[model samples]
Target chain A: MSLSIRHSWFEATARQRLAGLLDPGSFCEFLPPAVAQPSPHLAQLDLPGAFDDGVVVGAGQLGSRQVLVAAQEGQFMGGAVGEIHGAKIVGLLRRAVAERPAAVLFLIDSGGVRLHEANAGLIAISEIMRAVLDARAAGVPVVALVGGSCGAFGGMGIVAKLCSAVVMSEEGRLALSGPEVIETVAGVEEFDAKDRALVWRVTGGKHRYLMDDCAALVDDDIAAFRRGSIELLDDWQETPDTLARLRAKQARLQGRLSAYGRCRDGLEIWAALGISEPERVPLLDCDELIALKEGLPT
Target chain B: MEKLEFKFPSQALLAAAPPALCGVVGSGNLEILVRSGVDRQICEISVNTSARGFGETWRAVLATFAASQAVGGTSIAINDMGATPAVVSLRLAQALADYRGGAQ
Candidate 1:
């Protein structure tokens, strides 16, 4: 099997990523461009609307088991969830409830809501969260893959956390608030958008994986992502230990708050996690980082 | 909040017909929706821009596009932010190119 070099998973468009992830010739796109169902809100706001509204969703086969997929086009408005785009995602998860796909994959690459349609976008995200929880209750695994330049922030961050598992590349950043927004609202002294190293140290995949915020952290390659996801499909139980898992996640989050609530620097958190030479973690290559993680004393 | 409409004369449809969308609505960017209209001899253009007092410029730019492309029986709708004339033309042409399933 030859890998496509034209649009590697890290650099591929939303459509290309979908094609690369799903089984060959088994992917079927819903709400195709020919349907031309753009956002009515954009028209009302005098903003141009996309026919598929930044999200491509549909059913596909993943190694024989049926699955549903939704990939966001980060190039489009940061892949923000507006009315139509959010509705499309919600619709897919809802369908998963009745259809009972083996799993649902969300290729998240959004900065959350579209400010132009803030109210509608917010409500749509809320609906999507509910749909995600409902699908999980129905025993369908929810997986989030974050790798695009936009990464995931705002409400989408919370949505990603609610998933059964998250697969992220070292390039992926998962945070509740973006660096620029933090700087603007909290002052540059609190967070500087210009400080790329600091930004990555705080929210990069390595940090999140070490903190247990994300499940798997892999290299910035589509093949690496593919291996990570297939491992989840094969290893993860269909019906997870929901109660125990929730409780464990709750404990981990509580530990974070208690341990780092007062810390201002990301290095402090890294040092507390027992990483030597904390500053170098951000500079380490993906393979080196993974090896270091593997070599950690258990 | 400004809306402008224009009609152009042509006999052949664009490379792509109606119901095709190209572009995104970003900070200073815009989106274009191309639809096939009933009439075969007229190409319709409508624009709604966030910027004000650019009606004449829009008309000039769009008129030139209509004359050059000679797109017929198509209804083009645009949502613009503060995109310049150059960006606007590029987006319009890109929209048409994408509608034809060509490389962007």
Candidate 2:
């Protein structure tokens, strides 16, 4: 394949993302399209089914380290977690526990559970969550990379948080209820779905990174993500999932709620955190934002 | 959804290589998964497309693809979501290239 100067992770397909993120000629896919393990439920609903569902799972080399990776195809069904899709992810996570890779890099770009296979999708997400925790508890780091067209939302948002660390790009959104879903259920007065700025301000990577929700934020390019992953892995010291760690995480979340529970927007939270020009936060690039965050007062 | 299958006589077999996949099953796009080990003189194609009543279009496209490319001894399965004939042809060529390139 011809090399592009900058390949946008958001623009690449699930398979393409795997090819770009891993080392050259390193990826070996699991349950690839030729296997034809499509969703058993979509056919009943008269929907077109993809051969490998909407997610690709496999083991590949990230730099010199062997890492198991799973990437959701956001273009198909919004990269929703259907029964088979969820199962593929869950299986990969479980395998991570057995064949402990250096890390499990989860490329999240889903809108959460596939609504067409509602109950099954929900069950699959739950299983995936457990499998992720199980892998982490077994001393494997599960890192999440969220920079895709669909972004990460709903149960997948919670899943991303459950990982050992999350790396995101400014365009990557991470949240529970998506902007459109919130607007549909709570009225536009509460959250305007059409206002892309507001949507990003609330759930985008900059906000998440400032809030200490994500471990790192990088540019939208695939190489940036690969570099970010390498940096994190280089600094990785396996911290077993212990009760004390859980308590500390809970306390940090509690502190965040106490500090900015009533904040109306991300700008308000940024101002409360002592940012001089919160309004300009959205315009800053990844390096500038990281510098800004570092310059903030504790 | 519609399913169409076609087989074309080919002049030469594709060079032995690993299976290859190309494209995405997104809006106005399709994915082609090509695997070897079919009849040495025939190229078999199967399509599962969202748009129904386009069997003739798919047949023509696959026929041209078989004629132009040395895709014999391969089975190509496509999952399409209303991709245009141009996209179908492009993905077919790309997939064949990837297969011949001997990379997965």
Give the top-scoring candidate (lDDT): 2
lDDT by candidate, in order shown: 0.82, 0.90
Docking quality (DockQ) for each candidate: 0.35, 0.72
TM-score of 2: 0.96
Q: A-chain TM-score per prediction?
A: 0.93, 0.97
Best by TM-score: 2
Model 1 lDDT per residue over B1-104, tens place = 67788888866664544366666555577778777776777879887677888999998888888778757877888877678899999998987775555322
Segments of candidate 2 deviating more than 4 angstroms: A1-4
C-alpha displacement of A231 in model 1, angstroms? 4.2
Q: Per-residue lDDT for A1-298 in model 1, tens only?
A: 3355534565666877877777787888888766656677877876556667889999997777788999998877789999889999999999999998899999999999999889989999999999999998889999999998899999999999888899998789999999999999999999998998788778889888777778888777666776778888888775645688879878978977998998776788878877888888888877777777776654
Worst 10 residues of 1 chain A by lDDT: A1-10
- Number of the top candidate by DockQ? 2
Q: Label model 1 with its docking quality class.
A: acceptable
Tens-digit lDDT string for candidate 2 (A1-298): 2266888998888877888899988998888777756776887776678888999999999998999999999999999998889989998998999998999999999999999999988999999999999999888999999999899999999999999999999999999999998899999999999999999999999999998889999988888899999999999977776789879988988998998899879999999999989999999989999999999998
Q: Where in model 1 is the C-alpha error above 4 Å? A: A1-29, A32-53, A61-66, A75-78, A115-119, A219-227, A256-262, B14-19, B102-104
